[model samples]
Target: MTLVRVSRGVRMHREAEPDLAAHVRPLTRISGSCAASHDTAARLWNFPEPERRPFDRRIHISRPSGGARMQRPGVVGHRSRLLPDEVAYVDGLCVTTRTRTWLDLAEALEIDDLVVIADYLLRIPRPEFEGRAEPYATREELLAMLRRHPGKRGLLKAREALALARLGADSPPETRLRLAMLSAGLPEPEVNKPIRNDDGDTLHAPDLSLPEYRIAIEYEGESHGNADQIVRDIEREERARAADWDEVRISKRHMANGARRAVEKIAVALRARGWRQEDAA
Candidate 1:
């Protein structure tokens, strides 16, 4: 039997073969063929749990000589047309496209898992095969799918993906906070808006702000407690104080108790800033 080298010690014949044990051994790990559809596809597709074994299924490989078939006894072959750029050679097997990865993930994922997978896929940098894949659709079609399914897990995933793709590397925390606030029936604050001083110099851009009430709500995550961040926070507070803006900071702890107390605190601050209590209510 002639063997062609693919990876460090992996080999495959120039022609197809029936048993691919040697080729399958190294490629069965997490980062290897498991990431692609093959056996993993069954899991993603919600197939019945199979009894634990050494390998999942055998895959078929083609051989060059006529009538000489080599069947890999325990590997399942994932058949899909891949774009030239999407095809990645990892460990001796071809890695599937991100779109294919997501599709497989969607097939077996529960609602929440599906949403997360969709969100993660959308957030990936320059995701290849998005519009070029088999289920071809224009960007509008994709957006329409999201709009049609608003408040659904699929829509949440689509929205998250769109935001990540468009915003580059910005954290999604602010967006999530805003969504949670809105869902709780609070008026949406202007996002990432700058608070300026009398001299027109920008003081700080609060994550959320109410211009009329001179109120700001800042979401303080763990990063805020760092030494550099503490200094910046002091400066921001001083600027806000000079500008007569009442700043309210909310942490994950505050949010954990629900937005009632946070909302009430903001409402009181707004009232003190000459905003009508009724208007705030």
Candidate 2:
């Protein structure tokens, strides 16, 4: 077996690329004080960043304020006064809790990006698919975290993000679309609200909907480009048509220029469905 050196005193088979856990676990084990934090913890919790980037080579480790600073070749060390509950063990590796990770991210990301992550954390999880019934974190819990760390680096950004964050946004794009519409002076749409037929059977759960105007907005991400998903999307559009709902389908192209194009598409659909510009005001 060919062994590749990953970190000091740590080696792995060269055939397999080291995953986040593989890279961080050893670094955390270097001392009881160290825990995975910042971008590293966000990745572990599956928070969606504004833009995708290659996995950073350096591991982010945090120790208590008085702990000795880590001097390692591949580690970015931080010193903060962490509450006992702020850090937890995930899959045997020490890491900051989900809410703390978001606070850490607020320092590095824009307000929109922070809102995207906040939405991700607050979205209800599908127990059947996600293996858990509860959201990753809640608004109150996040607020409490903010209160605890009044002097934290990104307190203002985190608070702003929390104010904009809402439940039911399933993806970053969905959250961005909602934010864009708000920015364009459109009426706020319900997130992932189910539209049902007269008999009360659920027909479609649109990404965003204005039930009063029968407008359904769907943000189709990259997955929707697949042949199989395209067929399903067509069928979904037909259902909206049959139900007399104006369905606005948005794609990556529509997300250009701060999602101005997406807002325009949705605005047109809303107008056609009897929404008026003055109504939004």
Candidate 3:
């Protein structure tokens, strides 16, 4: 029977299916106090990160401050002051709390990227579909965690991200789009507000909206390319038109170069709907 080496001193059957859990479990078992953290923990929690190089296979583990950092091949270890409450268990493996993981990432991620994670945590989960009723974390919980870990390496950046983070952002692209508009001096757009028809029934909920200006903006991810999704999108746009709302559709390409092109599209829509450049001033 051929065995594939997964980590140092850890092996599995060559024909066995491998997964993140299979890799992480052995490393965490190396020490009772050690737990998966950083990017490893983020992955376990299903957090979204910005596009980067190929996925890293190394395991990131952390323990309380007194212990020496775990050093071994295929492992990147960190030592930090991990309070008991700052750690949690996910899928039977110990990991950092969602908010602490966010704080830890502040050192490595850009402010906007951090905000992307923050927005994700703050988004209200639909219990029926997501199997949870509440958000992953609350803004107040994040603030309290920050207060506990002042003077840390990325405290400043984390605080800045928290200030910019807003609820209702459903995806990284939506958060990035909102940030780009703000940086470009465009008025902040409302996130995911429902547009209702004449009978006061919800017509469509835009990813970002300026309801006062009667304009709705959507970020079209690659999934929109699906034939069925395209048909649904057309129907949605038709409903918006019947409701007297102008819609701006954005795609990944438009988000390039600091979302300059995306903002231009939205700005034009706003201008035609009675918004002015000076109004934002």
Candidate 4:
């Protein structure tokens, strides 16, 4: 019988198929009551990450103190004292709660990367939630969680990232772009800003905007390339122009390759419309 190794001393039929999170789950159990946490827990809960890792990455697990670390060929174990509320279940899989998983990421992620994940968790999908999707975790909840772990390894970085976390980002790229702008010393623009005409009727809302400067920065996702979306985009551009707003559209290519240039263009537009460096303060 040919068996594939899933984790140290754990194996299964080669044809049994594998789900990354599922495969990771048993490792936690085999290690004696640990839970899939950190990146593994985040994946099981569908948490948005700045970048998705590969299947081959080691499974991450966590447990309370006084237990043996789950050292295995394919597992990376974390030892932490978990609170009752910090452990939860999803689809019957034991994992860290949302805020707990996020706190776990502090030491493992860069400040900007941490902020991206933080913003993602707080995003509220009002339309999908019948005009009120409660946030996955409020900013206050995150701050409180950080406060509880004062001596944790990366608590300071976590606190800083949580401070920049906002509730309106719709995608990881939006969070990335916003951070880029702020890093460039630009004032934070409103996310999904509303546009209204002289009569005060809302026309459209752009992805990010500085209303005082009448400048909008929109992230054009791959879906924007479709014929129907392209047509609508053209119309949206025209309406934005009609509203006397200058726009700088950013795509994944711009984000991955020419982000500096894209952000500079936005700065130029902002400056042209009277934004000063001191204004950001």
Candidate 5:
């Protein structure tokens, strides 16, 4: 008969020798702040995967005096205080709240990147907002701050951030398609702007519209595959034509190439409409 001594509190393989010290080494390497969350009871007992990023590898733990005495190599420590509810114990490690996680990420990432992360975090299933005990008064408060900032850079950043923080499923393909246009250095078009007939009846709202150019771009997604959607799209196109607007329809396949071709097509259409690229630029 073969006998094996399985280590308690850590998984052991019968076929392999267990290195208890090696297993504990990783735990020791974690910064005290991240260890709070990553190594908390919820993660250890429940065995939940930690949502750690490359940036989190350098977490710095602060002392009660709101200062960091020592930091691990490659880790940066900030002297800050966390509220009680904002803290969670996991696997004997301290984890920051989701709100704090987002705030930190927002400060670190570019507006576009921050928007992507914010969108991802907001879409998380049943997210808990921790604004009551944090620097920001509320999520809306933060959004308002972004909106209040001057210039297109601030407005666009705020818009993207707010869009990311919106509660719902992933954004529609049209929204993503429009964002690609902005990222491609094209002038931002009004989103879902309406085109009305002379009779003032609402005709159609194109996915993106540049009134100055009298041009509209429509994103045809998988939903347009349905017979009803196709009919509606055609009707919309005809109405746009009647309204003297040059309309271009782009499918998901076309948008996958990152809007270079779409921008060219738009430029051509604008040229035909008596507008110059330099003028638009």
Candidate 6:
């Protein structure tokens, strides 16, 4: 079998025959109280990371001030004086709690990066999660985590991103679109707004919406262009228009120029539907 070296300490089979998770699995032992933290823990928790950031093969484990400095191959260690509430166990491995992970990431993430994570953690009506548990953590929980780390290095950026985080953003692109619109001075639009036909058939929702103006913003990924999804999307848009709602569809290309084109199209659609441009001005 052909092999590729992902890093000095990590190697992978060129073929997709084995479980990928096995490749990055760490051999770690904490002396007293230690847990996996940061990106390593993120992988364990199934958090969606930014596309541009790579997965580091080095395992990150954190200690809460009483553990011995245990060392192993491919392990990176961190020490923080964490409170009792900040640790959790999953799949038999001790790990930082979800909110604690968010706080830890503040030292490394940008405002946009933090917002994307926050949006994911607080998504409303998470159909993908089983048993109806809270998706990640609540907004207030995140705020309290920030409060516990008042003087942290990235506090300002984290605070800015925290203010922008909202529920109902189902994907990274949708969250980025919301930030773009707000940065461009447009009124904050509601995320994943549902609609129903006069006959009570539910269109379910669009990526973003302005209810007062009857505007819907949709970000279509590559899958949306698939023949089956295309047919369904066309039907949805046609039906939405027939119901007097304007649909603004965005794709990867529209995300260029800082989403200027997408924002412009939405602005024009809003104006046609009775929004005053001066209100944004």
TM-score of each: 0.47, 0.88, 0.90, 0.90, 0.51, 0.80
- Superposed Cα deviation of residue 155, candidate 1 (Å): 5.8
Candidate 6 regions exceeding 4 Å error are: 1-27, 51-57, 65-74, 125-133, 196-203, 274-277
How do the residues 51-169 of candidate 3 rate in per-residue lDDT, one tens digit apiece? Answer: 54222457889988989998888788899889999888767788898999989887677788789899999999878888989999999999998999879989999999999999998
Tens-digit per-residue lDDT, 1-281, candidate 1: 68786554456676855334345435544232232353343333233332222224444221222322332334444433333543344445444444444333332343333333333333334337444333222334345545543344334544544443322112344444454555555556776678887788888778788877778888788999999999999888878988988898877665544455566666677667776635536
Candidate 2 residue-wise lDDT, 16-107, digit = tens: 77678977888888778789998888878777856634334467899999877777787888898889999999888999999998898777
Per-residue alpha-carbon lDDT of candidate 5 for residues 1-281, written as tens digits (9 for 90 to 100)? 35443322234345665342333334433445432221221222222122222234333333223545435444344443454555545443455444444443443445544444444444424335533332222456446444443442335644556664433223344445555666655566776667776678777767678787778888776788999988988887888899888898877566555556776777678678886646645
Q: For all the candidates, what are their Cα RMSDs to the real structure?
A: 11.5, 2.7, 2.2, 2.7, 9.7, 4.6
Colliding pairs, model 2: none
lDDT of 6 by residue, 155-199 (tens): 777788899898889898899888889988887899886876677
Clash counts for all predictions: 20, 0, 0, 0, 17, 0
Global local distance difference test of model 2: 0.87
So what's the TM-score on candidate 3?
Answer: 0.90
Best by lDDT: 3
Against the reference, the lDDT scores of all candidates come to 0.50, 0.87, 0.87, 0.80, 0.52, 0.77
- Which residue pairs clash within candidate 3? none
Error of 2 at 252 (Å): 1.5
What lDDT does candidate 6 reach at residue 56?
A: 58
Off by more than 4 A, model 5:
1-102, 107-111, 116-140, 143-176, 183-185
Ranking by lDDT: 3, 2, 4, 6, 5, 1
- Which regions of candidate 2 fall more than 4 Å away from where they truly are? 1-17, 52-57, 197-202, 225-231, 274-281
